[model samples]
Target: MLNYEGIAASKGYAIANAYKLVHPNLSFSTMKIGNPSKQVKRLNNAIKRAVNDLNKIEEVVITNMGSASSEIFKLQATFISSPNFINEVSSVIIDSKVNAETAVSEILERRISKLKNAGNGKFVLDKIKDIDDIRKRLLAYLLNKNMSDLALIQSPVIVVSEDLTPNDIIQLSNKNVKGVIADLGTNTSHSAILTKSLNIPSIFGLNNISKNVSNDDLIIVNGMSGEVIVNPSNELVKEYSLKITKYNQTEKPLDKLKKRNAFTKDGKKIGINANISSPKEVNLIKNYMIDGIGLYRTEYLYIDSYSLPTEDEQFNVYKNILSSMNNKPVVIRTLDIGGDKQVPYLDNNDSSERNPFLGNRSIRFSLSKTIIFRTQIRALLRASIYGNLSIMFPMISELNEWYKVKKIINEEKRKLDDGGIAYKNPKLGIMVEVPSVAIMADQFAKNVDFMSIGTNDLIQYVMAADRGNPTVAALDNPLNPALLRMLERVVNVANAYKMDISLCGEMACNRYALPILIGMGFKNLSMNINSTLDVKALLSLLDYSLMQKMSEEIIKNACTVKDVIKIEQRFIKI
Candidate 1:
């Protein structure tokens, strides 16, 4: 067994033979070119065939994945077919009238040129990520354009690769894909995000797993632990299989907790909320028995498009989510973009930071460009009419900054009324992530309808830990006494102000933190969809009075994080 660790991008268990996908050792410069006319015709046929193959794959996904999953694939195909993408390629092929390989290269070069001209250099680079594919497509066009390199792999296989693009990952869905391990990928990589969404087990940054493991060797991939056991003896497989069975059995009890309201023994109701980005995730609301969506990340509406989404486009998305949840409150966070996410229309001039999380990003970047913020505020306000919508500003700290957003909201409302546009004035809230905001939660609670503690950032800010940096990840603990003190203060303020408060970050999803949250009088916990039931179960099992006492002891005694963890374990049954 060779063990490696990485953040589990998705969830599941798989035992399969390693099916390594080695990158072609060959380079573009070494490939041979044939007769131009034959190559052109061959390349066109190959494109046609590849398109047809993709279409068939889509149909298979539609049947297997049903309506919900199929929409994602269809949207991806639409992206490929967009005028900005397809037209550029077609025009290049026609205008150049060269061999298919040359035509594809010319098209790519022209697109790169256009991107350079546009001045958003990042946008063009993000589009054509598969450098090897470009080379092969060109080579095939020149030599035998009609040739198709697509091959169907037999399954119960562990897919090993140098890296995977979003398009490549999408195409693998509903096929007998068992597991995926890659040589390279970051947490925010498109491939990682998509794989997580698909619920497939994956491990990336494996440096050389493919070279060591042979095809058809029985291997167990523990995604949760990031361990791979190759050629495990039968006895070892059975032992691990039993362990997995026991874990699954433990999970079965959680299902019974789904419909039960998450309240402690003292009858305190803790609201279990969810975080969602798309309409497709709305189904999670009912399935997970969540109180509402605590955070509705709106960046996806802008990231996937060539241009800024029209007010109507944004309106449709917000309205769809609102209507789908049947009036459950959704805290629609205004665009939180920085680091890897860059909107073309927005003048995001923040340089890549040595520590991107702590640097200029989120609300700071949005406020720098007021026009973008105002447009989004207007759209969100208009959508509020359809359901229980609340606006939460990200990275807010100073009082002046809070009011700055409020001023824009007020102005947008006035403009809407002036233009006879329909909208509802939803309550606004702020995310308490920066240490400044956490310290001033009392004053902030007095102004806003609610305060959501974004622990992911708060810990990053408080510990001065950059979560993106692997070396510092161990230090990113929300259970730290410093953070617990902040949460206590935030909750106490919310109680004083007669306002609601919740946490909507990675911490909310963790079962161990539920006792502490409820103990601190935080009745609302928002997290990813799958974690709702798990947290609910943990909440149901604990005595609220004991948790409260335990929480107070930690805050009052000023213990370290380890001490708090020990105290929590001693009290909570989990």
Candidate 2:
């Protein structure tokens, strides 16, 4: 048996034959065009087809993994579908007077140069990979050639690739693909996220993993430990086969929690909600005992196209999601688009902002254009009659901002009433992302129906660090004394008013933070659908009352990350 070790990307065990996936040749020489108009038409059609393929793959990913894993593809589709993209392609076709393929290859190559200038950091490197994927998709379609479609494979095989793209990893998940071995990517990469979403045993960061393996070679992949064995001895295979059975036995218990409600040891019911972006993800989590859809990221509705989704279109999607929950609460946060999430189609998106994250984002952009805000509110209100719907606004930094948004909602409601449209009144809420709101949580609690602490931004805003940027990403810590204090204050106010309060940020997914939040008296908790079961399983073992007392000491005495860690370790041992 020959063994190799790499970074574990996804947890599972697989024993199958190997299939090597190689990158397609995207290089093409510039050729003279017959007609500029015809070439432009051809380029446009190719782009449309590419964007369509990305969209379909995105839906499959969302259904399989939820919205976060699907985001990479969504971004790729948004880039290709933008007017700016087509305009540049058209300019190249006319200016260079070259064939459609040559124009595309040239434009993409020029983009590569601009991206290279951005820097060689991990983020830049990831973008380069994304561009490469886009380049491959466009060239393949234009040239009428097929790339490896693992979905078409009839039997199970372990895929080995030089560098797995989001496109490649997702396609590998079609069926009969037992595992993935890739030479590039870390657990944080888009490729890794796709493999995990598909529940494929995958190991990335292997050196020339593709070159070392041959097609139909017997392979064993242990994703939990990042172990890959080629042509293992019969004894070794039998041993791992038992381990796989044991591993699956442990995982199936979490599946039992699918139909089980989340309750603390003391019989206190805790809410476990889903934070999803697209309506389609609702189908994946509906069977789980999620309290509700805590956050419906409406920005995805805008990112999928060159123009905004019409009121009817938004209404239908919202209705489907709300209906699927069957009277369970659904919190739809309206248009949190800006910062890392951008929609170029909207005229109101201010590209010139020096620091876009802190300026004209979320509620600010939504309010900047009342028509856009009104249209969404009208849709949400119309859909409210179908199930329990709560409308939440993001990035409200002031009481007046909340008041201004409420005024717009009132206007939309009146317009619906005037048109004789039947709509139920939804519980109105605001995301407590800004420090200003968290500082005055008590004051705001009086004005809103509920509060959801979006710790992803609150921690960053409080710490003055961008989570997306690696240089300062560590400082965006949920365990920071400052952030913990702010969170403590918000939950206290929510407890005082008997209002529905929940943590729906990245912190909610943190296992360490979970017990602390529950101890701090958070009955309502929301996180990604993928993490929901684990959180619930943990809930049954936790004594909420005991956690509440432990949280008090951590809040009072824990001063640093190390301090928090020490105290949590002591408490967990109990």
lDDT of each: 0.69, 0.80
Give per-residue CA lDDT, model 2, range 1-574, as digits (tens).
7899877767789999998886666667778876799988888888888887777777766665557557777888888888998899889889888888887777788877766565322123224556766888888887877666564566889999877643465467566889998886555344565566567888877877688898899999998788899999999889989988998898888998998889988898988888876566687786787778898888867764324667898999899888988899999989987775665446334567888888888899877877788888899999999999999999999999989988888888898989999999899998998999998899999999999998877887898976544345458567787788889999999989999898886577566788888898888887767777778878787888888877898899999988887888887752
Q: Which candidate ranks first by lDDT, i.e. highest?
A: 2
Query: Taking the tens digit of each residue's C-alpha lDDT, what string does model 1 give over 202-298?
Result: 7765666668776677777676666667778888789778766776788688788777777766677888887765566776467666688898888
Best by TM-score: 1
- In model 2, the runs with Cα more than 4 Å from the true position are 1-30, 33-245, 347-352
Candidate 1 — which residues are off by over 4 angstroms?
6-12, 19-34, 60-98, 115-154, 157-218, 224-226, 340-354
| Candidate 2 overall lDDT versus native | 0.80
Residue 332 local lDDT, model 2 = 93
**Ten contiguous residues minimizing lDDT sum, candidate 1:** 120-129
